[model samples]
Structures are given as structure tokens and as C-alpha cells.
Target: MTPEAFFFEFPDGRKAQVALGDRFLVAVAPYRQRTHPCQVHYFSSCTGELREETFSVRVLEEGKEVLKAQVRTGKDGFFELWLPRNRRYTLEVRQGDWVAQGALTTFAQSPTCLTELRLSRR
Candidate 1:
């Protein structure tokens, strides 16, 4: 089955599309093991190229970051963070040299829910 897809809307009215499965692949560092999976997508108007990256997702409360222990997207084009247990936290997605950073408040119980993030350009 094809994975669900979501869109990241920017403040400038630009929307980038990301796939929850195929487009978002995870690769662990140091061990380079495939751990968590995420949803991510990246595109540049100047370069006109799209790349995908994935990484582990971590949920941070106040200031402490707790790894959600799930594979997340962190490629050059797309990324996602899986929140644990539905709480107010910050989600960060960095792809390749380009980093699209945004904060999303979501819940872990709502697995099928879509979290909207406003990311700044690199």
C-alpha cells in the first residue's frame, strides 16, 4: 500500500509536498542503522531539484529532548518528527545542507493526523 502524503505550507504561500513512506527514508548515524521512519520533502525554487532524507525523531518538552525512538525523514528534500504520547513539543527537520526548521505541536495518539509546519529558507 502507498503511504499517505502531507504538504508543508510556507509563509509565502508556497507549499511543498512530502510522502509519509516512500519519500521519507531514515538512516541512523554512527551505526548507520535504519531505525525510525519519517515524512519529509524538499524543493528549491532556484535549484528546481527535489531530494529526500530521513532521520530519527525526538520530542522535546520545555528544553529537554527525548528521542521518540522512531525512524524519521531527514534527507535533503523532506523530513518529519513523530511525537510521543501527544504533548506540546518542538519538531526540527534538517535536510542535507539545506535546513527547513519548524515547530509543530502535536499528539502521539493521533497517528493519522497531519502536523503543519512553517519553515524558513536556507
Candidate 2:
């Protein structure tokens, strides 16, 4: 008895040619785009209300800074940062004397990982 073979050609100029038995399974892992979302909210502790503030956002991987940006919260006191996936990262947000720190671990399956941070000061 002889086994059969199949060929698969991907659009990215990659080809997979393999031989298989009668009962066989073909598993293919395609390319995926992974992204991590980080949201920051700022508020006034004395007023207990949301405030639009400019913040310095930093993303660190393995104790080394990879991304740094000066972002300002929207009218709703919200700001978002998008990062790459499949990494454990340390996120830092700072504004004046108020600072917030958090960590996020992104997964390949769930590309859109959301991390929320709140910073408030009197």
C-alpha cells in the first residue's frame, strides 16, 4: 500500500508538500496580527471627577524601555496604547506628581488584551 501526498501553497510565497496516510490530519498555523490595548484614566481626587490630563506612557520589556510617548487623555479622561502581543510588559503612566504602574501579558489567541489604569491626585 502507498500513502498519498498533498501540497499547499500559501499566498506569502510559501509551500508545504507532505505525505499522509489514509487517516491523517493536517494542521496549519497561519499568520496572525497581535495587539495589546492599554487604557488610562485620570481623575481629580479632591473633586472625585474625571479630568483630562497629559501623561507620559512607557512600555518596558525585560527591564528595558521599548516605547515612550507623551499622550493626553481625551475629553472622557481616557487614553489608549497599543502594543505587540506575546510578551510580558511593564507599563508606566506619569503626570506631574501622579503616577500609575501596571503589567500585562499578551497571548497569541487573544490578541486584543486590555489593561486599564487609573491615576488620581489631590
Candidate 3:
């Protein structure tokens, strides 16, 4: 049998998604990532070393922007984001003259934690 997915919603209209039996994952900010039980996507943005720096993140679908922010990575060289389930998004991260681009899919079976988004000089 498959474990069912669920959501947590707050009075302020913010929400999070999780699956039954899912282990806890932590989040950090500019988002402050305070929304617990999030469908956490943890990323390390790196350039030869773990870094704490400013990044512009743009999440898009079908050429239209959905979520966009300029956030700084935590001291551990990580940042977190949450997205709605079962959709594909284009993620673009920029820092100065470097850029990293990738695809993200929020499928129920997708990975919740991953390593670096390696940036390349542009």
C-alpha cells in the first residue's frame, strides 16, 4: 500500500505538504523557512566551496514566473524552498557573474533533499 500525502495549513493561509511516514527535514531562510512540515527542498549553492551568499531564485512554469526571490544562503551553504505538489518547474539561480539552472519536479515520489546547485561563471 502507498502512504497517503497530507497538508498543514495555518490561519494566515500558508500551507505545507507531507506524506505519512515521512521523516522530518529542517529548513532555513530568508524564508526563515519557519513553516514546519514543509515539502522541503534543500539545496546547496556552491562554487568550489560551501558558500553563504546572495542569490536570486526564480521558479517558473511554461515560461511564466510563479515564485521569485533574492535570498541568502545560510552559513551552512544551504537554502530551502517549498512548492506545490505534482508540478514541474524551471529554477534559475544567479549570483553576480555566475548562474545555475535546473529543473525541479514536486512529484509525490521526488527527492526532498539534494546537494549543490553548482554555479558556472558567465
Candidate 4:
């Protein structure tokens, strides 16, 4: 038996890289647009169906919500969001029946920060 592998490609020649000074990175890639590299890929309402155009993001720290950012999916269904420094966040996105959730790590200048729900489904 052989292990199957997944591959991603980006279109529009746009790319996001985490620099030495940067603390966060986000990206979205859609099929049929062209092969590109993306940290995450979204599925359409139908299982196994690829989607393009729609995404949302949020940030949290120490289990406390902090920042929220909304993203518009491009023709290729790709979106990107940035977070503050030295903090953490719970990221969520919904597309039709499909929903994606994950945690993002960041940093804060102060030792204490506010907690709140930064993002939600509309």
C-alpha cells in the first residue's frame, strides 16, 4: 500500500509568508484556479466539492477573544487574516454547510488583554 499525498497551488501570483519579524500568517486556495500553496482549503456545500469566494477570521488570547477580521473570498476562494502579537485566537469560518474552526497563536505587548468574541457566523 502507498500513502496518498495532497498538493496545493495558488493563483494570481499572490502569496503570504511568515517573516522572521511577523507572528502570523493566513491563506486560502481554491481549485480550478491553478495550483498554489495554501495553509487551508475550503469545501463547498456538497462534500468533496471545492469552493471559491468567502471566509472569516478572529483572534483570541489565553482563551479570551481579542481581535476579529472578515475576509472576502476571491475568484479562487482564498482569504487571509492577520493577528496581533503575543496572543492567541480561535478562528472560525462558514461556507454553506461547511464550517472550519482552529486556533491561532499570537502575542500581546502588555501582560493583560481583554477577552471577547471577535468573530461569528452571520
Candidate with top TM-score is 3
lDDT of 1 by residue, 1-122 (tens): 01245567889999887655423222122112222232222223211122333433554677787655434333333333433333565555443443333354443223332223323346
Taking the candidates one at a time, how many backbone clashes does each contain? 21, 0, 1, 17
Candidate No. with top lDDT: 3
> Candidate 4: which stretches are off by over 4 Å?
1-23, 29-52, 106-122
Compose the digit string of candidate 4's lDDT tens values, residues 5-92. Answer: 1233358666453242443434433233234332233322111113355544545556666756666754444454444455556655
* Each model's lDDT: 0.38, 0.48, 0.57, 0.40
Q: Name the candidate, 2 or 4, with the larger TM-score value.
A: 2
Q: For candidate 2, what is the lDDT?
A: 0.48
Give the Cα error of residue 3 in candidate 3, in Å: 11
Q: What TM-score goes with each of the models?
A: 0.35, 0.49, 0.59, 0.41
Itemize residue pairs with steric clashes in candidate 2: none
In model 2, what is the error at residue 112, expressed in angstroms? Answer: 5.3
Off by over 4 Å in 1: 1-52, 55-58, 68-82, 107-115, 118-121
Give the per-residue Cα lDDT of candidate 1 at 66: 65
Task: For residues 45-84, write the lDDT of model 2, one tens digit per residue.
Answer: 1111233667787879999998899876545444545555
